[model samples]
Target: MLSYATIGVTDLNKSEAFYTELLAPIGAKTLMKMDRIIFIGKSMKEPMLAICIPFNKEEQHCGNGNMIAIAPGSIEKCDELYNKAIELGATCDGAPGQRIPDLFYGAYFRDFDGNKIAFNHFG
Candidate 1:
């Protein structure tokens, strides 16, 4: 339904570092991008991280207010991914847990640039 998904950020390097470690075990990585943009998702040739060159003071925070949700396979995998994201330094926006009893298990995190990112496991 879409070509790709992008999350904005403030620091490319910090975001890159965080993403590299977080996405590694999941098979996601920095694909391609300009200095002001860092694409970290699945390939190093695509830009999934649309980070801000510098901290934008006028920018609002990252949240459902403006965020993307990625659903992996199982709740356990979701938990692992969420843990990896945090271990790499992404801020915890929402912790990994049952979002809806027996319905959805997911977790949320804020990237280095403060973009809201989430992982959901529905199966």
Candidate 2:
């Protein structure tokens, strides 16, 4: 139902570098780039994540209750991706673990620009 999700950022180049490397494990790369935005994903046909400067020309800030959830297909992969996010300088929102006993394994972190992301696996 979603084509892409955009996260506002202050530095386009820095955010682009951060996301491109962090998501590389999932086969996501920079599919497209514009002056103020870069789209990253496995393909344009799949859901993509966009990091960009605000169109309104104001300062970029994260919303109070917004997050992007990604399914890595397994608990172990989720853990690996979560650790990669940390290695890329993201701050932890939650550590990797089962969130709903046997049903959900997930981890959360905020990127350099404070955009929240979840590496999740559902059984």
Candidate 3:
């Protein structure tokens, strides 16, 4: 029942690019200016991470154990992004494939650091 989620990152520009590409399908809104902290979600929804702050790089991964599941508009979208991410130098932690066939069809990829992010589309 949450409107969004936020995470601290070390590099603002890089993380912005990564997330902007990653969250394209979900229509993620990016806003970060000292003058104002804009709301990503709609007026009725809660805000996600508004600003990108510095964090320890010594950490194992860019993300916590929790998996951020993004809903792809379609299976092809997932396939395209999954492939694009891999092509863009992201490690393919898991290939795009159906987990349980009809039930769970998705893909997982590792970000700049090491985060197991998944994208799914239930046909």
Top TM-score model: 2
In candidate 2, which residue pairs clash? none
Per-model C-alpha RMSD: 3.3, 0.8, 4.0
lDDT per residue (tens digit) for residues 1-123 in model 3: 766555544555676676666555556656444422222432335435343353344434454576666666788988887887787667887788988868777888876756566778887
Give candidate 2 regions above 4 Å deviation. none
Rank by TM-score, highest first: 2, 1, 3
Worst 10 residues of 3 by lDDT: 35-44
Evaluation by lDDT, superior candidate among 1 and 2: 2
How many clashes would you count in candidate 3? 0
Give model 1's TM-score versus the native structure: 0.76
Please give each candidate's TM-score.
0.76, 0.97, 0.70
lDDT of 1 by residue, 58-87 (tens): 553555587777766678778888988887
Please give, for residues 5-107, the per-residue lDDT of candidate 2 as tens digits: 9999999998888888888988999999999889999999999999999999999989999999988778988999899889989999999999899899889
Model 1: runs farther than 4 Å from truth? 43-64
